[model samples]
Structure formats: structure tokens, C-alpha cells
Target: MKQRLDKAGVRFRPHFKTHQSWKIAEIFSQEGIRQITVSSVTMAHYFARQGWKDITIAFPLNLREMDSILMLPEDVTVGLLISDSSTASYSFPKSLLKKSVFWIELDTGHHRSGFSVADFHILTWVIDKLCSTGAHLQGFLFHDGHTYNATGIEEIREIRYNTLSRLSLLREFLSEKYPGRNFLFSGGDTPSCSQELPMEGIDEMRPGNFVFYDLQQLALGSCQPEDIALSVLCPVVASYPDQGRAVIYGGSIHLSKDKLTVGKETIYGVVCSEEKQSDMRLTFPGDLPFLTALSQEHGVIQGTAEQILNLVPGSLARVIPVHSCLVVSNMKQLVSADGTVFETLNLHSVDF
Candidate 1:
């Protein structure tokens, strides 16, 4: 991964929202990753406490958290995303304006937020206001979130091209219209970042989920099962041979209900008997396919009576989550490779 970014001449400022561990953050810091991206203000604070000097809250700046933002250390360089609203421009405390860096987000392909590339007049107006405040207009940042919906490599490539084209056009417009204005062009998504990066005009890339990939990335052809670094461990509680089903302690509370379906086949989660065992095999038998039908306090596994009978009640099962981000966020704690329990990090004060 480092070699790939080095070859492209693009700096990597990995998003730390995937694995919110201070230990992992230190690893990146030691690797010379000075700058990092996060999803919330609390995350910024958490990593900042862990000794991160530069942090960018990729989401829109929260107007209500102005006081909390002000309390951060002055040496900690902070960047906030600004969009159509002048709220961030006007609401930000005048004292912090000089120290704060504002990146006008551009909506290239994903219609989530930010001023659209086509809305040149409004974008320029926002930039003018931000520049007037003397707050450093730190380039542009965007995420090609729509890449997740891509069905094949061709679609992924098209999304990448369109996103880059849009961003380049906007950058060129900014350059010609306002020359000598220093700025950085940054964009990334797990799929596009994992495949190949085209750093024509981009200065930085922020890929979050690559640290702990999941089934969604696998289904999208982004990464293989070997790239997946996390899974849920659940103990089989019961086996109903008559109904060809078994129940596990892991359910919606442990592993989320998110599922991936390809044609008629549905894979809720990949099952393994152990975590440390490298030769761990998934529990789907040849004759009876395993499926997680319902999940609450129990994960209902479906298969043939013979296959169901084979699973012992006291056995342990490891289930690979369909969406690692959501599953990890839901978990309050995680066990490391050595079986040490570490509390899961939380950024959002309110549950999403």
C-alpha cells in the first residue's frame, strides 16, 4: 500500500474511523503519516489525545460543537469541511478562524453534500467568503462514495474517471480564476483506493475501511478474504436437527443484520470455528447451504438436518461481517489476536 501511493506521488492520510484504536493510530504516526481524516469531532479529539498533530473532520462542521472545537490545542492543526451554507463561515469563532483551515467540499459524483461542481457561482461565492475571513482555504476534499454501488470493474473505472474529471475541471477553474491560491486536491474510497489510483491532480488519498475490510469489499472485488482483518466469535447454543437449523449466541446485537445477496444465494456472514486457527474452514456444507435467517439474541442458521446435527452445542463459530464498519461501530469491545479484550473506541456521542 505504501509503495502504491509512493509510485503515484500521492500522500496517504488514512481515515482512522475504521479501527479507532490508539495503538493503530500510533502505528500510522510512526510510519510518517502526519495527517489523518476522521468522521466526527469526538474522533478528532480521541486521535488528538493519542498525539495526532493534524486532523481533518471529513464530515460537515457541526455548528453546535463550536465550544468543543475551540477547546482543542492550538498546535493541533484542524480542518473542517464547508458546503453551501455560510454557517461554518459565520458561525466559527473569530479567534479560531486564523488557526482553522477550511476545505470547500466538492460534490463530484456522490450527491451526498458539498457544492456541486456544476454550481460554479455558488461555489465561488462560498470560497470568496472563506478567503475573506483570512481562514486558510485548504484545497478541496471529496469522497467518491457512489463507488460502493458499482457492480463491476468497468463501473468502478467509470466512476473513478467521472469523479476525477469533475474534480480536475473544478481545480482548473479555481486555478485560472484565482491563481497563486495554494490548495490540495484529495479524494478516495475503499474500492477506488484498493484498485489503482489515478493521481492526475489529486494531492492526497484517504482510504478508511482498508484497515479492516469486510464481505462488501470482497463482493465488490476490492479485496480477498485474506484482506479481512476482523470477525465475530459466537458460540453455538443449540442444534435443532428436525428443523435443520442451529442457534448461535451471536445475533443482531453482536453481528449486524446487514447481508449481501448475489442472485439467489445470500451470505449473512462467513462462519469459522475458531479465530486463531489459520486453517479455519467455513461451516457451509456441500449438501446443505448455511444461512442466517433471523437475528435477535440468537442467530438462526439454516441447513439440512444432517448438517445441523453435525454442529455441537458447545462449539465456537466465527462469523465474518458483511459490513465491517457498521459491525465494528456496533461493538462496544474487541478481542485482539492474543485474546486480550480492548474496549472499542467511540467517536459519535449520539448513536447513529
Candidate 2:
């Protein structure tokens, strides 16, 4: 992934929020990935303790967490995102605000958290407050998350193009209004970055999920089936040959409940044979089972009666998650391709 980004001349500052493991981060460090992106201040501090100096808290600034945000280690250079004028004007510690770089989040048609390009009022308003408060405005950043909903490669390209076009237009406006200030335009989703979509004006690409593409990215044509890097190892506890379904010990709690529409059915994951996982090469249109349904602690695999018979109790199945990010958050540990087991700090960990 870093090779692809370097070849494309795009700066890679991957979001580490996907796999919150310093050990996993060590691999990225070995690959020379210096900049990092995370979802929260707590995560930023976690990585900071691991000696990550350049970090961006990708989520919008939380006014309530000013105490913790301000206390981030001084050795680290932090980047914060501001989604609206409210966060811009929110009471922030001037010391931290001055030291931190700020990126105004652009909506870019996602309808998620970001200032709309059509409404330059909010953009300029936030910029004005940043200027008044002496906050370093690092420029605009956006996430073309809508691309995940695209049907195919062509549709993905179209959505990404339109989103980038809006960010470029807004960039030009910012350039003209604030003549001397340089604003870096940053944006990317897994579908855009992994597909190597047109990213002419984007300064840095933060495609976290590209590290571990999942069923969703596969369906969006962002990655090949073989490119998927992680899967949940589940044990078959029950097999219903008559119904052509098998029950596994992995479910929403382990693999996440995110669903994707593949063909006519909505599924939570792709169930590949444990043998296939050992090979680490997944073929397209392969004879893998689909997870038809999921409960809190159980997953139902759909397959033919004959195929279901193969999943007798005590057997294992590898489930490729629909959303790697959410799945990783739910998991407490991971096993690398070479069979190296490492622990992960579950960002959303809770005691039952």
C-alpha cells in the first residue's frame, strides 16, 4: 500500500484508528510511514506514547475534551479537524490551539461531518475565527465516504471526481480570498485511494481501510479479493445440513455487524474455507460461503447442504469482515499472515 502511494506521488499519512496496536504500527514504521491519523485525542495520546511524533486527530474537535486534547505530549505535532464554525469558536486552550494545525472539514456531498462547499459562509466563518484566535489553519480536508455506496468502478470514479471537483473549487475560492496563505487540500477514502483515483490536488491521502480491505471494499471494486488482509477465525459450533446453514462462534461482537449488499442478499461477511485462509490467496468467484445472518455472539453461514456438511462441529471458518475498521475495533487481538499473534488496544473495549 505504501508502495502504491509513493508511486502515485501521494503522501501517505494512514489513519491508525483501524488497528490500534503499536505492534502493528511497528510494521508501518518499518515501511517508513511517519505521519499517522487517528479518530480521537485518546488514540492520539496512545500513539504518541508509542513515539509517533506526527499525528492527526481525524475526527472533529471535541470541545468537552479540551483538557485532554491540550495535554497531548509537546514532542508530538498534532493536527485537529474543525467541521463547523461552532467548533472554531468553541473555547480552546490558546496554547494548544496555537501549537496545533487545523484542517477545516469539507462536506463534499458526504452529508457527514464537514462544511459544505456550497456554503462558503461556514467555511469563511470558521477561517475567520481561526485567524482571530491565532490558530494555525492547515487548510481543508474531506472524506469521500459516499464512494463506498457506489455500485462499480465507473460509479466510484464519478463520485470521487465530483467530490474532488468540489474541493478544488473551494480551494480556488480560499486561494483567492486569502491570497498569501497556503491551504493544503486533503481527502481520500479507501475506494478512492486503493483504486488510485484521480488525486491531483490532494496533499495527503489518509486511506486507513486500504491496509486491510474487506468485503465492502471488495464489492465497491476498490480491492481484489486477494488484497483483503484480515479475517476472523471462527469455530463451527453447529451445522444444519438440512437448512444449508452452519453456526459459528463469531458474530457482531467479534466481526462487527456492518452489512453489505452483494447480489440480492445482505451479508455481514464472506466465509472462506479455513484451508483457503491458510493459502492466503482468495480467488474471485470462488466457492466461499457467505455469512447470511449475524447475532451478538453467533454468525450464520449460508451454503449448499453438501458444503454445509463440510463445516461439522469443531471445524474452523475464516470470515472476511464487511468493514475492517469496525471489526478491528471489536477485536482484542490479531494474527498476522506469518502466524504472529499480537494484541490490539480495542478502542471501544468494554467489560461484559
Candidate 3:
């Protein structure tokens, strides 16, 4: 990701929500990444304590977390996301707003959060409110999350172009309205950042999933199969080779419930040996050996007769998740390929 972003001359503030491990962040620091992004104020707190000065909480601003946000060290710069006017004016202290970096999340057709570029009235209203409240207007942010629905690179590139064009027009309009004001535009979805698209109006790229490409990104042509950096290790609890089925001690709790369906088959994950994640291969309906269905505490692996004939019930099974971030979110820590242990922020805590 740094290679692609550096070559394109775009600032890389990678989202730590993918790994959520401060130890993993050390690896990023070794590669010269100073700025970062997270999904919650607690994450910002975790990384801030790790000495990350520039932190952007990419999720929408939570009015309840104002106290926690304000408690951070004075030097730490926090960027908050606001999707509507109410959140902007609800109860942020004027002094906090004075030092805050406000980002208006833009809905470039994902329909998730934020004002759509077409809904200029609400968007403009939110922007005006934030600016009036003394928050530093940090310009627009668009997540091409919809790009995940694309068929290939061409579709992803098209989404990227269209989003940037819409954002550019918004930037122009804002600049014309407020001359000499420097509004920094920044946003990135994994699919958009993984490709060789042009970074024109974008100021910085904050892509989380790119850090650990998953089966979803792989299917979208955003990354190669080898680029995936994380997988879940499930213990084989039952083996039925004659029935071409196996049961593993991994389910929604371990891998999350994210899945991908191609033609007649639904894939929760790709089950493979320890060495070759791509070796078992995932094809629609028939190529064999995929994590076909998942229950709360068990996962069903289905394949051809020979595919699972060698399985031993006591052994461990490796499964590549469809969405790495969701899988990582469920894990309390990460076990590397080399058996190294890495700790992550425990969002599952009762306090969180």
C-alpha cells in the first residue's frame, strides 16, 4: 500500500482498525508511516498512548465520546467525522471545536452515512454548521465502499473516477464560496486504493482493508491472493471424508459472518492447509474445499471426496476470511505465520 500510495504521491494514513495491534503498527513505523486512522475514540486513545500523534477516527462522530476525545494529550491531533448538522452542533464544547479537525463524510453512492454530493443543501448545511462552531473544516471524505460490489478493475476504476469527479466539483463549489480557504479532501476504500487509479483531488488515502487483503478484495481484483496477510486457524473437530464434509471449531465468533456467493454457492471463507492459502482454490459450486457455511460455534467445510480424505480430526485447519477486518475485530490477538503473538485493543471489553 505504501508503495502504491508513495508512487502516486498521496499521503498514507493507514487505518489501524484492520490489525488494531500496536505491535503491528511498529511494523508500519519501520516502513515510515507517521499518520494513522482508527474506527473509534478508544482506538485513537490506544494508538495515541502508543505515541501516534496524528489520528483520525474515521467513523462518524459520537457525541457521547466527547469527554474521552478531550482527555487525549494536547499534542495529539484528532480528526472527527460528522455526517449531519445535529451531530455537529449537539454539544461539542466551543473550546474543543476550536482545536478540532472536522471532516464531513460524503456519500458518493454507498448510501451508508454522510451527505451525498447531490444533496448539496444538507451537505452545505452541515459544513456551514461545523465552520460556524469553530471546527477546522477538513473538507470532504468519500468511501468507495460500494466498489466492493463491482465485477473487476474496470468497474473499480470507474467508481474511483466518478467519486473523485463529484468530490472535485464539491471542492470547487466550496472554494468558490470560501475563497483562499484550504480544504483538504481525503478518503479511500480498499478497492479504490489497491488499484492504479489517479489520485487527483484526493489529499490523503486512508485504506484499512489493504493492510490485510481478504477474499472479498481478492474477488474484486483489488489484490492478489498472495497479498492477504491474515487467516483464522480452526481446529478440526470432525471429519467425514466419504461425505466430503468436515466440521471445525470456528464459526461466527471466530471468523465473523461475512460471506460471498458466486452462482449457486455461498462462501464464508476459503479453507486451506497451513502453507498454501490459495492452494485449495475457491471456485463456484464445484472446485472443492471451502468454508461453505458457518453456525455460531461451528463451521462446515465441504469439498470433493479426495479433497478432505486426508483430514485428521485432531489437527488444525486454516481458513482465509472473506473480510479480514471483521475477522480481526473478533480476535483478541493475532498469531503470525511464524507463531509470534501480537496483542490488539480489546474492544470486546465490557467497558467499551
Candidate 4:
């Protein structure tokens, strides 16, 4: 992924919100990934202290964290996301403002966050406030999250093109008004970034899920099933032969409640087996089962007679998570490919 971006001359600022582990982050650091994007101030501080020189808290900036953001060491560059004019009202210390870049989050039809393109008035209002306060309005940052729902490559391409087209118009407008100032347009989402998208106007990519694709990505066609890098290791607690269901000791908490519709059925996760556990890459082989339902502590996997017979009490079953980010976020620890255990950020307890 880095090679592809480097070849295209697009800056890679991988989002760290997917895996909030410093040890996991070192893997990227070793690959020359000095800059990163995160979702929270806690994550920004955590990565900054680990010697990451550039970090962007991609989520809308929290006004309450101004003090903490100001306290960050001068050597570490921090960027903030501002999606609305309300955020522009908060005053920042001159020192902090000088060291920060504000990416105006553009709503490229995602409807989740950012100012809508049709509502250019909001963008103008926010820009005016930033300029008045001497804040650095870097450029536009976008994530076409709607692409995640796309079922085909062409649909994804259409969504990406629409987003870029809107961004190009906004970029032109910003350039015309603020002459001679370089304004960047950054865009990313696994579905759009994993595939080739129009990069004429986009200056950078900030994809986080590509680091750990999941069943959701597979279903979205963002990646092949073999590209998925993680799965849930669950213990088979009980087996009901009459019903042909194997109950596992993993559920919504372990594998998030995120569901994907495959055919007519909505599944929480795809199931693999203990025998194939050594091969972490999940293909959801035909012989494997699937998690049909999940409770807080129990996951019910249904399979054929041969498959159900294979699962026994005290045995382990591997289930590919629907969403890797939510699964990792809820967990306190993770087991690596080499069977080494490492702690993950307890995001639930984090103040931010």
C-alpha cells in the first residue's frame, strides 16, 4: 500500500484509530510511516509520545481538550479536524495555533460529519473565523464512508468520483479566494483507497482499515477474503447435535455486533476452524461453519453435520470478525500471529 502511494506521489498518513497499540504502531514506524491519523486526543498524545512527529486527530476537535492539545511538545506536530463553524469560535493560544493545521472536514455525501458541499456558506463562515483568529486552515479532508456500503467496484468508483468532483470545486473556490496559499485535499476509505480512484486533486490518503481488513471489507469487495489479517479465537462451550449448532464462548463483545448481509441472511461473523487457525488469513472455506447469532457471551455457529461434529467442548474455533476496528477497540489484549500477547488501549476508560 505504501509503495503504491509512494509511486503515485500521494502522502500516506495511515489512521492509527484501527489499532491503538504502540507495539503494533512500531510495525508501521519500521516501514517509514512517521505521520499518522487518529480519532481522539488520547490517541494523538499516545502516538506523539512514541516519537511520531506528525499526527492528525481526524475526528472533530474537542474544544475541552484545548489545554491538553496546547501541552503537547513543540517538536510533535498536531493537526485537528473541524467540520463546523461552531468549532471555529473556540480560541486557541497563539503557540498552539501556530503549530497546528486544521483540516476542514468536507461532507462528500457521507452525511456522517463534515460540511456539505451544497452548504458552501458554512465552509465560508468557518474559514472566515479561522482566518480572523490567525488559525491555519490547511485544506479539506474527506472520507466517503458511504462506499463501505457499495457492493460492486463500479459503485465504489462512482462514489469516489462524485466525492473528488465536489472536492475539486471546493478546492478551486478556496484557491481563488485565498490566492497563493497551497490547500490540500485529502481523501480515503478502505473501499475507495483499496481500489484505484481518481487522484488528480487528492493530495493524501488516510486509510486505517486496510491495515487489518475484515469480513466487512471482504463483503464490500474492498479486499479478497485472503487479505483479511485477523480473526476471533473462540472456545467451543457446547454442541447441540440435534440442532446442529455449536455454541462458542465469544460474542458481540469479542466480535462486534456489526453485521453484514450475505445473500438473504445477516451474519455477525464468518467461521473457520481450529485446524485452519495456523493460517490466519481467512477464506471461509466451504467446509467451515458460520456464526448465525451472537449474545453477550455466546456465539451460535451453525454448520453441516460433518462440520458440527468437528467442533467439541474445549476446542477452539476461529471466527472472522465483521469489523476489525470495533473488535480491537473493545478488547484489552491481542494475541499476535506468533502467539505473543500484547496490551491494547482500553479506549472505553479513556477520558477523551
Best by TM-score: 3
User: Where does model 2 exceed 4 Å of error?
Assistant: 274-286, 347-352
Q: Mind giving the per-residue lDDT tens digits that candidate 3 earns over 1-352?
A: 8998888888999989999999999999999999899999988888988899988899998888888899888888898898876786676796677556888888898888887787777877787787776778888777878898998899988988888788878877877877898878788788988878898978899998887898898888887777888878888999999998999999998898988986678889887655665553457655547888899999999877787875579988878889999888888889887889888887534444
- Tens-digit lDDT track for model 4 on 1-352? 8987888789999988888888889999999988899888888877777788899889888888888898777888888888877777777779878889888888898899888876767788888888789988788888889988887789999998887788778877877877888888788787888886767778999999998898888777788766777788889999876677999999887887998776666778877644563343423334557787999999999878778887888998878888999998888777888997756767434644
Which runs of model 4 end up more than 4 angstroms from their true locations?
Answer: 274-286, 347-352
Candidates in descending TM-score order: 3, 2, 4, 1
- Mark the regions of model 3 whose C-alpha exceeds 4 Å error after superposition: 278-280, 286-288, 347-352
Rate residue 148 of model 4 by lDDT.
85
TM-score (all chains, Cα) for each model: 0.89, 0.93, 0.94, 0.92
- Give residue 27's lDDT in candidate 1 (0 to 100): 70
Model 1 poorest 10 in a row by lDDT = 280-289
**Better-scoring candidate (lDDT), 1 or 2:** 2
Question: How much lDDT does each candidate structure score?
Answer: 0.77, 0.82, 0.83, 0.82
Candidate 4 residue-wise lDDT at 70: 80
Query: How well is each residue in 1-352 modelled by candidate 2, as lDDT tens digits?
Result: 6777788787899988888888989999998999999988888877888899989998988878777777888878899999977777876777887558998988887799988877877788888888788888888888888888888889888987887778778878887989988888777677887776777787888988888888788877777777788888899999999998999999778887788876667888877754564343333333667888999999999877887888889988878888999988887788897888767776433410
Report the alpha-carbon TM-score of model 2 versus the true structure: 0.93
Alpha-carbon deviation at 37 in model 1, angstroms: 1.0
